[model samples]
Target: MRGYKQPTVSVIGASGYSGAELTKILARHPSVKLDKLYAFSQAGKKTTDLYPWLAVDMTYEAYDGEFDSDICFLTLPHGEALKLVPDLRNAGKMVIDLSGDFRLKNAEEHLRFYGREKPDDACMTYAMPELFHEEIRNATAVSNPGCYATSIILGLAPLILKPQDSAKVNTVCCSGISGISGAGKTAKTELSFSEMNDNIRAYKVARHQHTPEILQTLGTSATEPSFGFTFTPMIAPLTRGIYTILNIALDKHLPVSEITELYRSFYISAPFVRVREMPPEILHVAHTNFCDIHVAESGKDGSVVVITAIDNLVKGAAGQAVQNMNIMLGYDEALGLT
Candidate 1:
């Protein structure tokens, strides 16, 4: 690898929260060159203009029909990346989309959940690194997981991925409280300072878009999940992080230590997932790529509760995207992440 050159990378929609975070991470990456930053609205402005703390000297430009980089990170809003991904892939540039555009494999479910029609060729490898690492490594296009989906999937993966006959999961009821940052940089009356200062409310109860995403990852379609799953997503006053609590009912009772050991052994090779002895807090993983999970028995009726914490913008969005990029580029998975 002596004569190897670092790959050039570009970011589309670089003015948003997740986009800016991705830009900062790519700027510091050792194996990739940060080339272009595209933010159509903020085009012609310097990167430091929006983020005064960044030391990089680059201007945001509007994306033309051309892409000069080997890799492209599309951090556009929900329906935007659907328009750009085809062109980027046709140009032979590796694409990583941070939107929900290509996350669902079933087109019917996509339209039902996202309320948008996607093309038939919208099948991109789902990039949940802990579960789909090998698929992502060989993928030309990857769809990053959603914030709530990331926290919940990682919390439940150990239990459902490889289930014991005696301990099959019957029901999974979980609630996720996320920071306001998960709403992105869009201005909304409901998300205003006075409205959300000391208020917390649940939105998209059973109709959350990420519900299908979580179910899809656990090896079942949304309409026909192997186990019962219910998710409630709430927005809190904090600026970052997602805290998820899952109440699971199993066919047989498993000890708290047994469940804890199952999680630890499952994620043993996963560097970013930590199995904690005590429950993790939102602050513990606010800005880091790590997903801290803790499990405990709830009742004698074969029930248990699993708790997980992660930064909504990091492990849930930008940081996980970078992890996929590293695997795709054949670099160390923890290269820029650590």
Candidate 2:
């Protein structure tokens, strides 16, 4: 008991959207100790100095040496993450990744989408604590789902993962705009305020990369040999949080009440998800880690619609990573996460 070392956590690429959020959250997380926070730009600077709002009563220190932590959080971009994950594992640090690097199972899939090599043999548990909780609990490395995938998957996993009737399904999702904060501290012409303010437009029609990640995770055992989808994203005039509306196509009809009952019963064990009576408002879930969901149907058509919303950066990324860590550590599954 006297020799115990606090489990240390590090944030690599801590200057970006998801990275910064994770840094702030982990800085205050109770069970885990904040070991090192790294940023290429603000490498030598202090955390409070870079993001004054962090106000955590800490100074920004340089990543002057190798970091040793029970777990390391990667907020790096997809391409960069592949390189970092393998080394981190070799160094014997368990990992929790917030990027898309390790989510896809096939290496070629990673290459096809991001033009990057798959991290070879760097096995990681897909970190969607609800469906893959067991895998995560024993896994050495963890891959967090993409932001959009988190909202969409949670909205539909109960039906798709273990389809009650094994009927086929389809899905659609929409996300709100966040401040350039979501884009990170980096500079991008497309994400500039002038272009994003007071505007709403769907960018990637069917080419959003997250589409395949979503389909891969949620559409696992469907019988259809080929699938078709319509996915579109818009830039809402907000700073953070993504409001997503997803519709799931079911081949068989289930009563709206039964559907609600099923969802309520299905997610009863999931802490961060809430099944609401009326469709949930984004604001209710906006600064929190909750995913508020509502279900509906036209009755005649064998289709069901699920509307879900969340703070894209939270439940969609950092918060989910923490949830996976809680599972992996066998701590209170909700400890320090809620």
Candidate 3:
């Protein structure tokens, strides 16, 4: 740490799940100094008081104007970030937004899922580093993908034959129950220990907000011509990690061995993506940024199954945001991530 030029960084909405993860990673990041932590309501309190687990001690301030840093990570809610990101970028700050605000290419797509009018500004490049590393590297603003979107997109990327229409690809995604942390630190009766204990219930069937975000990413990718999928999200009795069971309808069947090899070959250059011989478990990637993937044959006609596991707040949100920041700043892609 002696001769390195540390970049100054800040986290807005620093009281949430993803924000806490970002704070933890940046505090120990070799080339970055977390200069500020901002929370609108918890203005004068200590970050540790809110998280009670972060080793880095910092005071949370209410956002007044711009951050005095080279980069800013916005972990605010879906509609909240659109109001602030434009100003941040205009102030010469690189922004990485962890909201669904700017993920879709068109404003109408955002409205359909989130039921809010999308910002009328220029598009922010979607920054799933494994799929769009080069674009992330050059963009001043990047929209980080959602947790479920990350799992589904990475799981199906390899088999995409050509750019298909949005209605062409037949996709079905079933995600395991997520931890209470993903719901944030707020107190809610339904998220209580007794209610969530030993229970698994599916919520947001087909109407999940992340649905369009996934479609937008897969629809725009060169290899996948189009995408159409039903996403079912369930809540499991856990504190972290997401396991997604993805079933896709294909035109023809590819051997399991060949499918596995294809996935392995496609992700060979991706450091955080591991192609596994067996299915992945959430515990293996529980607190890390890695996305473990497995491919197999399914009984459904003309369909293949892909299983992917990742820590919802890490690879899906905070960790991926930092990864994008590293790329934008010309640092080693894995510098602070590994």
Candidate 4:
């Protein structure tokens, strides 16, 4: 390790679940030096106060407009990250945002869904390493995909990548069952342990903020294909992970075995995506960065069902951000992730 140099990194929203997970992952990252831990409200608190399990002894600093790190991660909320990312990029800092602010390319769509004006000069690449590996590698700013979007998009990518008739493709419906952690660390009366126990409920029916994100990715991932999708996000009793069922209707039918092979081939070079024989379960991917996917053919028509499971906090947010960081820094994609 002699004569080796490492980039300095910082986490802006270090108190939140995604931020804390990013902090933990960066702490173990061999290539970067975690230099600052900033939080808006929990500024003076130690990381152990928020996450008792982490071995780090760093105290959170109040997020003043001062940061001198080589790379910065904004794990803040949707509307919050917009205000900071542009400035960070201007100041010559590589920024990876784990928010929906930069995911939507259209400013009007961002306002329509997130109920806020998009950032003035937001130019960033959407970071889904398995799909946008080249873009993320060359970009200074990266927008991490949403949890539900990550699960559903990876499940459908194989089908979308192929040539198909736009008219023949039917509706794509996805139902995602997520653990309570997807709601974030904020305390809500409905998200309480007493209320959340033994309960399954859908919150954002047809208007989840992540809906457009999935649509946008699907629209571009395929060539000359018009496929619309409906995403319903539900909350389960557990504390981590997401399970998504994607029902895709197409004009052409491929056997289940062929579909599985297609998916496996699509992710052949991806270090974190796994193709499974049986449907993926949340427990298998709980603390890891892996997204487990299963493909099956159903109905007499040309319908293929894809089931995917991933840790919402990991592959969906923090881990993917770090993976992008690795790519941007020219390190092995699975360097610290494994």
| Number of the top lDDT candidate | 1
Give one digit per residue, the lDDT tens place, for model 4 in 1-338: 11227899999988999988899899999888999999978988999988899978999999888999989999887788877876787898888999888888767767777888865456479999999998987888899999999998898887886554531457788899999989988889999989989899998887788887887887742212366667788999989999999888877676788778878888999999999988888889998999999885555587878899999999999999999989888889887889
Writing each residue's lDDT as its tens digit, candidate 1 over 1-338 gives 12238888999999999988898899999888899999988999998888898778899998987898888999998999988989899988899999999999888999999999998678799999999989987888999999999999999998899757658888999999999999999999999999999899999999899999999999887899888888899999999999999999988888898889999999998999999988999989988999999995657798999999999999999999999998887888898988
The list of candidate 2 runs beyond 4 A from truth reads 1-5, 59-65, 119-123, 166-180, 219-227
Compare candidates 1 and 2 on lDDT and give the better one: 1
Model 1, position 209: C-alpha lDDT score = 96
TM-scores of all models?
A: 0.97, 0.90, 0.92, 0.94
Worst 10 residues of 4 by lDDT: 220-229
Clashes of 3: 7
Q: Which residue pairs of candidate 3 clash?
A: 162-225, 163-225, 164-225, 164-226, 165-226, 177-235, 177-236
* Number of the top-ranking candidate, with TM-score as the measure: 1
Q: What is the alpha-carbon lDDT of model 2 when measured against the actual structure?
A: 0.71
Give per-model CA RMSD. 1.4, 2.9, 3.5, 2.7
Q: Write the residue-wise lDDT of candidate 3 on 1-338 in tens digits.
A: 22237778898999888998999999989889889999988889998888788998899989988578878899997788888887898898878999888887767766777898865664699999888888988887899988888888899887763343321245554555566677777789888999998888888787788777776776552123255566788888888888898887776555678678878888888989998988899899998999999986754355778899999999988998988888888888788888
Candidate 4 to native Cα RMSD, angstroms? 2.7
Model 4, residue 99: C-alpha shift (Å): 0.7
Task: State the lDDT of candidate 2 residue by residue for 94-142, as single tens digits.
Answer: 8888878777776665666667776556446778877888888788788
List the candidate 4 regions with Cα displacement exceeding 4 Å: 1-4, 119-121, 164-168, 220-225
